[model samples]
Target chain A: MNKTVNQKAWFLVLPVFVVVAFSAIVPLMTVVNYSVQDTFGNNQFFWNGVGWFQELLDPSTELGGRFFDALWRNLAFSAVILAIEIPLGIVVALSMPRHGWTVAFSLVVMALPLLIPWNVVGTIWQVFARGDIGLLGWVVNHLGVAYNYVLDPASAWITIVVMDVWHWTSLVALLCYAGLKSIPDAYYQAARIDGASRLAVFTTIQLPKMRRVLLIAVLLRFMDSFMIYTEPFVLTGGGPGNATTYVSIDLVKLALGQFDLGKAAAMSIVYNLVILAVCWVFYTVMVNADAEKKEVEA
Target chain B: MARIVLDELAHSYKPGPKGPQDYALKRIDHVWRQGGAYALLGPSGCGKTTLLNIISGLVVPTEGRILFDDRDVTRLPTEARNIAQVFQFPVVYDTMTVRENLAFPLKNRRVEASVVRRRVEEIARLLGLSRVLDRRANNLTADMKQKISLGRGLVRPDVAAILFDEPLTVIDPHLKWQLRSTLKEIHRELDLTMIYVTHDQTEALTFADEVVVMYDGAVVQTGTPDALFERPEHTFVGHFIGSPGMNVLPCTVEGTTARVDGQTIPLAGAYPDLPQGRRIELGVRPEFTTLAAKGAGLPVRVKRIDDLGRVRIARVDLGGRPFAATVPEGVAVDGDEASVILDPTRVHIYADGHLVAALPAGATAA
Candidate 1:
């Protein structure tokens, strides 16, 4: 084949560049503008020169302490959600009916929690976990456990974690179910012919085949749990003395509640960078493992 | 090692079957002799795979019992039945190395580590996978992966039988012959009863000791390749087994001679007292049917002659029915002036598409 270079292809891609400049680039530039400068009323702005960033980074400063606390809370929340969801999802996916009318019924049922609006999930849990009027609240109180989500930090954390689990476990389960469904029956048949036990079949055939889907599940759950806002906001409102004020909730409190735009923008950049860095590390490790495996195969 | 027997085995994928078409395998009673290689030759949807699955115990027949030697194993699971099956597609444990894949069954059965190692090494060497023993099984090409699948079956020498269900379909065309020959060699060395299923006649004929021809979910004929070629019991077998197949022409049979559109052909053996309402036909191989001088035999209009180097295949029309005659290169056909004469020794009379007359012991001339 002879090579023919064409410059006119740039005309085809011009619209996508213009769209990205408007939608993503302009807003990001606004964030960059806010992060570097201090603004007092009437659109008056002055350069702060990384002062907000330094304050946000230092644990000694009040602002930095609060930011660190929220960041760690976000990390812990993501960790807990992943630990609970991945295995629970795998089990649910495995136990779901593999074929027939029951599969459709079960899939619709599993998707129910996900279909509910985020704030609605919070409101539902808020009413459902009340210490007085709510059924769950009354039952727990009557059982003498003294459960109170609005007042107690522990109960608030438990309530939010349970709410998140109930809201998002279905996503993980659906992904794993798709993974399980993709495995060919011949693998299982061969396992049976090999006299493999149930656990052996799962470990040798099913689990390995599900690896790629599980990676996607982990990445999705990690990012979603870290950026969580509405459900927890509506549920706890960051109450019980900041016990569950994740970085996003704290950033919202700073930017909108106190109107600290510079501090909030600085925190936003740090939060995004943290997520990007962590996710990048994760993505690289997984991709390199896949590539090396392919090399061995080649 | 075991003489696998199917005693009146029938399977219907549908429940509450009403007619013969409902059954995937309809009441097949056959015995595969111990340590013999057999090929189940059939077109797709002819229940060859169903029968293989029954023998492997992957599928339990809806009717009848299977026996391994003397013990009835109808309800036994595939593992308990101790059979290996290489499927149509290559299946390998993606995470395991080639050696581990071969050793998987032995390890699952709790074979000692030393023995498993020895057996894995032996099988790997035999399969020409010794260099790739450490490579991941899933990383290999299709042919190599298929070899690993075969090696997995070959590693376990104690298995009663090994069933291959079109295992070579994914293989590259040039490698198919080599892989088939490898399978044949493995079968020769191992004492396992092997039943290979394929729709390709050449693959079946080249691989097995006896070929079992199936049609419409029924076992039509079971014979050696020579028997299948020379004396196909059913017309389906006659049409299926050979290149260009045997020509079956509707005929009127009266006593020892059969007539096709006023052209008479003598039968080598008498088909006396054929049943009423049965359609009589004459079946003869294309190789045995010759083109004689015009007006001396069944007058045919020569349509085409394909010169295949060593022999010429003359395509002719006999009384408006297409016929094929394989003739030596020396024999030339004059266009539009051809007549075909089927060799009496090779010709067989059929009653209602079933072979009625078998070639007699000492018949030399037509």
Candidate 2:
């Protein structure tokens, strides 16, 4: 018997490679070029030789001050979002009906916020949190809470967190719901037969089964939260001080606001590196967990 | 172990079953002895699964009561029923190891660690899964995963009854036989009250001591394999329980003889008083019908012959109605001239949708 090998299959992937190189690789190369050199007005450039990187490492300068603070804030935000969204998503998913028109309705509703553009989400929240016209702000004010999100750093932070939660928690919920739905009805039957309590069912059957998708949900949410720019930028304009200024917001301000191209470029590189490094660690953990799972099976 | 009983159970998906067509499952009254192996057998959408789910407390009946032993458990949740159910497909925890999957129910019940380990190991050994005890269930093959599912159900000896809902459907054909025998062995060793549900007649007949043949959501007959074969109370039972199924021919009965297809066949006993002008049918197993000399039987034309190694099945036309007859492999008959004689003692007569007569009995076509 002879086997046929077709080299023509490479043509299928050629388009994807071309598109990715044009959109992603070209821009990344440009970012690398800016990171290594100092460019003044009229496109005049000087070789800075890691000068921006050194300045970024130093804590005394404004760059260092904003960079480290934003980095820490981004990390904290990702953690908080992950902590809140995953459990909340699981709870919501569990409460959903197994099979019905309600499942379709809930899925459509959950997907609505994810479909809205990021900038639009920011604008919606900004208007929605206004003390005078916004329903949430008006309600809080009416309740005698003395809330002003634009002027108050604490309120601004709260509003951004709440907005982010409202916008992105649905993604986690939908992913978890899909995971839950994929589980065979047999497991529930077995659990019922075992006399497992509701809590037992969730912890043993639901949580363990959803682990893979839950990891994906957490990683995606973390990366998105860490690099959040448009929503906070539009919501508070990184105002009420640095309370709402995330790393991506700071990166934008340095690159476009002040035109400190070298420092901003270097910082952007560093920011990307940080996200990449953290994401690598998360990816490694997920992959190793899967590998270990496979090893156990083997 | 508990004796499961169903008392006047009928289920309808919609409200107010005004007539026969409205009910998904007609009223059934039966009892399953404690520690007995029983199978609910029927074709697809035949309420066999529905009845099994009702027994497992997964589906609540529209009417009637389900009793576990003597205690009424109609309204009890599945968790409260103390029944372990294995689904058609394997439902083991994909993220958990085989050991963990088997131990889950035990762990949920707060069984002692030593006992859980011992019981899990025992079941794993029984199912030939001990070698893969630590393997994650998702990585296993379909048969292995099904074995894990089966072991999970069997691990808890304290379960009142173990219900299998076509648990071997995902298993390969060759492996299904082995698993069936393994299940029978486990049932013997554990002496658990097992109610197996399957559409496969072979599986039901071979696996269960008493096979409950269900049709259109009601159990038409519950008897041993031989009894069900010999004396089917409903026409559906006769059709569903056999390999080629029973040949049912419309007939008119006059005293102790039925005239089917213009041929008179002697009835072994008197039939029950059936209303005049009521439609009647005569039922006979293909195995009991044999080829005989011409003028002594119903003349049939041999349409096709399937030589099944040991026995040959002849597909013939009896009075323009397609009928099957199992004959010896060497039986000589031309394609044009074949006559089949149904054993008088093995024939059945039905009236008003119920068996009215069985040969050699005080047969009533009621």
Candidate 3:
């Protein structure tokens, strides 16, 4: 077969390249430039070359110590939220109404939290969980438990995780619900005829059908939870001795509050790379599993 | 392994069905002898699937009861009924191997592992799926998946009956014949009561020992395929069973003679009292009605001749009404004019779409 080489096709891709350059590549390059250089006011810059990266990597130093703490904290938060959210989302989806007007009502209610602004969610939870006059706080206090997010680090962590779950689990549920809806009625009927128990049907039919949607849900929740900022910042402000100060919040503190330009830029690059690497690992593992199954079939 | 009986079963999708028309399935009473293969044949929207679901306990009848060997199971759930059903589309667990798919029913019922394994092997061999028993069901072809569905149903030894609801609708045309034969072979070998539902006449007629023909939510006729072809109990059956359906013509009956458009055709039996003020018609299949030259019998205008590979069918106009009659080979048509020769014994009288069973031979009509 003869292949045709067309140089003009590159022109068609040039427009997209230009848009991406301005939108992403250019800003990322600026951050890279800042990471390798030191700047003192009046726009004066001196080459630091690898110094900031080296300092960030060594946890013994003050900057590196804070960065490692925040990184572990962010990873823990993502893990905790994912462990709670995925199964909870699936259970919520399974219990949702399959038909009637109530389906619409429940869907709208599930979507309401997702529609609320991130900072607004934080603010609402902040007040709702207060120890003073807030409903949750007053209720918990009256119930003989002392629960104050402002004073207790564990309470602050609980509040943020709960807040994130409330805000984002709906996206996972809605996706799962769509997956559940796509299954033909025949499968259920057949399962019934086969004398499969409810649990068996769920494991064999529902879970297999929901595989793709659940993959998407896990990836999205992992990425979003890892990079979480506004909600926690508004709710706890990484307070109570930096107990809940995740990486993004700490990064903001370094760049904007402390004005540690080179260190912050370096941290930002490392954070972006970590997310990219984690996502790549997830994709590669899933794709390899699928390929292995195909090879076994062949 | 059980004789199934539907005693006055009926169903309606509505909460309160005000009249018969409101019912999706009209009243039906049927007795399926144990080990007999039956086919519920009907066009789309004829409630064949509704009746099948009711038998399998997927649907509860609005009235009356179903019995399995004299056991009343009217309100029983599907799992309790011990009947397997293969749906219109293949329903296999996508992640499971073909062996697991076949063994699922037995395992679900908590059968012994050795028994489940043996049953699964027998069913896989019967379905010509022995080689692919370890392959994932999701990767198999649609027909193979469908066979897996059938295998799951067959794996259970305690199953009372197996119901198939248009299971071949998704199969390729060439594979349909192969799968159909496999089903027949399984039925013969297992001696299981299998009720196959389909709209295709060929599938119903070929697969079933006795075909129950449904029309508009009612069984119009239930008999052997030959009986259905030879003597249709209703005008709809006569029309539905044949390739070119039975020709029904508006007519007036006077004793043994029926007058159609002022021309008389002889009848085998007398119909003196069909009904008063009701539409009476003559029903005769084109296979029994032959086309001939103009001077042979009742005159008709030959509209066209369709050569159906083996037999040529003459589409004709009889007194301004369209009609179909078989044109025998070597009887070449020279012009538009022709005559149709009706077999007297094959002619039937219908009143308001139902057959008027001819008064016993040589008996006077009351």
| Regions more than 4 Å wrong, model 1 | A1-17, B358-366
lDDT of 3 by residue, B1-366 (tens): 899999998999898899999999999999998899999999999999999999999899888899999999999999998799999999999889999999899888899999899989988899999999998898888899899999999999988799999999999999999999999999999989999999999999999999999999999999999999988998889888889999999999988889999999988998867889988999999999999998899999999999899898999999999899999878988889889999999999999988898875477554
Over the stretch B238-308, how does candidate 1's per-residue lDDT look in tens digits?
A: 99988788899998876667889998888777665567788878889899988876876888988998877
Q: What's the CA error at residue B162 for candidate 2, in Å?
A: 2.1
For model 1, what is the alpha-carbon lDDT of residue A158? 88
**Model 3 residue B230 distance off true place after TM-score fit, in angstroms:** 1.7
User: Candidates' lDDT values, in order?
Assistant: 0.89, 0.86, 0.93
lDDT of predicted model 2: 0.86
Higher-TM-score candidate among 1 and 3? Answer: 3
Off by over 4 Å in 2: A1-22, A295-298, B95-100, B112-157, B293-296, B358-366
Chain A TM-scores for all candidates read 0.94, 0.91, 0.93
Kindly provide the TM-score of model 1 when superposed on the true structure, using C-alpha atoms: 0.94
Per-residue lDDT of A1-298 in model 2, one digit per residue for the tens?
Answer: 9978898989999999999999999988888788888877799988988888888978888778778988888888888888888888888888877787988898888899999999999999889889999998999999999889888988998898888989998988888888998888877877787777888788778998899999999899988888898999989988888888888888888889889888888998898888889889999999999898777566
Candidate maximizing TM-score: 3
Best by lDDT: 3
Q: Candidate 2 docking category?
A: medium
Clashes by residue pair, model 1: none
Candidate 2 TM-score restricted to chain A: 0.91
